[model samples]
Target: MSSSSAEVLLVRTGAAATLDRTSVGGRGTVASALVKTPRLGAVSVGELGFQGDVQADLEVHGGPAKAVLVYSDEHYDDWVAELGRDLRGTGLGENLRIRGLTERDVCPGDRIAVGSALFRVSAPRRPCYKLALAHGIRDLSARVQRSGRTGFYLAVDRPGEVRAGDRIAIIEHAPHRISAFEVNRVINLDKRDVDGARRVLTAAADLPPRWVAKLRRRVDGAVESDASDTARLYGTD
Candidate 1:
């Protein structure tokens, strides 16, 4: 299949900074790089991520497999409509916002070339409360998952420079044909989807190992894992 004519709308990077907030639902100080600034020109891409980009929580956020986070600019309209507010400069903490492709259009393990960098689609982002905190929406993280607008992560295969307006083209497609949407659906929305879980496992070699283990256990009929600490992770009362 031909690659979609995806164009990067923005390239953003940020360092970890302190955000102090007090609200009816919550109050605290947190270190986050969720607030990103647009990079005006080409930026270096490395095995970890774009130059100057940093994740506050390395435990859950950044790693070799999640070097870059890509969001679909296409979802912004839906979000604006749902939130009933102006989000003109809000990035929702994404590294690259691009058009012409969404979760359904990309599959795990697919190799994509954007600018001079080569990347492999990794997995759907499992959003948490920092996203909600960033947007001041208590349920925004949950909304992102349930809406199937969960942007994806990219593992840099060949480190190079990237910048705004770079063309995104898939150089190789995953053999399994399972889109990132289906993977997120199986894991977050359709936990009972045994068949879907099996299909996801077919692409295990190309997916994040943590997700692979989760699916493997599901396929083996193992007991469901411990529930996520939603209150802690989502900052909801």
Candidate 2:
């Protein structure tokens, strides 16, 4: 393992709310909890998420495998340079804004201890329309995916409380599995990487079933059409 240490820079949470068409350009009203704001001091964490945190779409979000969203502050500078704005704070809707850890550092199944709670690296986040709507950029979701700065999700292993400045120590690292960055690279960015997909599937037994199934499909030669991929990647509007 590298000498880099993971540390929490911020903790954020928010409830789901309805958005009108005007707010989403012309895509009609929708419900989303993507507008996360920093939470002062320690915050309670559970199997689902932080105490007040809510996800509008349980079908795609807010489950055990995706209990918490984590973003690396290491990417914020690049985001600001790309978006031409101050992209700090909870603009990315991550429950934990962390430093010294990125997709390349953690692999699926790695156990992490943060504050009083423990978590496992589950999967790399797949950006959707909510991100685009939040930033008012039509293709920002796709851009994020292609850029490989898509952050990641975590499953609560031992629920407790977390606070800013908490050290994120990896207690158990899954050396056999590919890092989250490699997953995103082969599956999202380099779509033609069949051998890479196979390698991921071979070692990613700890990933969610849906994610495993998705990779299995790709490796088995059942790739989705570009139109379908676009819809899944960006969502409506």
Candidate 3:
């Protein structure tokens, strides 16, 4: 791979290289690639934590049309489930299955070039019970309460088109220290980072200052999300 390129892999919705783009309910066509932006933090499918390409731009009812995409971690532990005795990856309902892009490696404002689709890393996606249920898992909220590998969010920096199997390339932005993983960890804590909250907005154009201050107060100093033993493997905690 070229120094400017990274091997990005995702399961194609179909075997086709290009897809039709539409809203959630609509019959979405396959694309060469997609983009994501952070609206919330922490994405969990079933019982896994992960990062990267957290969401894809969708035509929403009222919103700007960003939705959480689903994908299963390919290289994960397998076990028997109550529904069926089988090996299961992280119990996440990611539209695009991710392999190498650990949550910490990418941050908001970072752009990824998959095939021809230019996606801007918006922020980290938040985990909710809906995700768990979607994947036939239980207590997804609780699992995320313990693990903060929420999916990342993206905004189409330069929307072209995308699909699975396209290679993802990193296009860097300024103040690249904070990553989606770190942002998720710090923001979820009981205490908040007043400064950090504000700093993140710099990367995201839509986020307001009030929200940032609110986050700092939540984290206070202790950066724990689900459990008090909050530690991060991707970005700084």
Which candidate tops TM-score? 1
TM-score of the candidate numbered 2?
0.92
lDDT of 1 by residue, 79-149 (tens): 88998865547677889988888899899999999999999999888877777777677787888888989
**Cα TM-score per model:** 0.93, 0.92, 0.55
Worst 10-residue lDDT window for candidate 2 reads 18-27
Pairs with backbone N, CA or C atoms under 3 Å apart (clashes), candidate 1: none
Q: Give a tens-digit lDDT track for model 3, residues 1-237.
A: 231544434432211133232222224443322222322322222211122332222321012223224232432332233234332333343445555575567766666665455555655665543333333344443445345556665555553444444556677653645777677765664245657655655554433244466565544653435442222211111
Q: Enumerate clash totals for all models, in the order shown.
A: 0, 0, 52
Cα lDDT for residue 65, candidate 3? 21
* Model 2: per-residue Cα lDDT over 91-186, one tens digit each: 777999999889999888999999999999988998876777676776778888889899999999999999999988988988776888888887
After aligning candidate 3 to the native by TM-score, how far in Å is the CA of 173 from where it should be? 3.4
Number of clashes found in candidate 2: 0
Cα lDDT of all candidates, in order? Answer: 0.84, 0.83, 0.44
Model 1 lDDT, residue 160, Cα: 96
- Candidate 1 stretches with Cα past 4 Å from truth are 1-4, 21-24, 223-226, 229-233
Q: Candidate 3, 206: how far from true, in Å? A: 7.6
By the TM-score metric, which is better: model 1 or model 3? 1
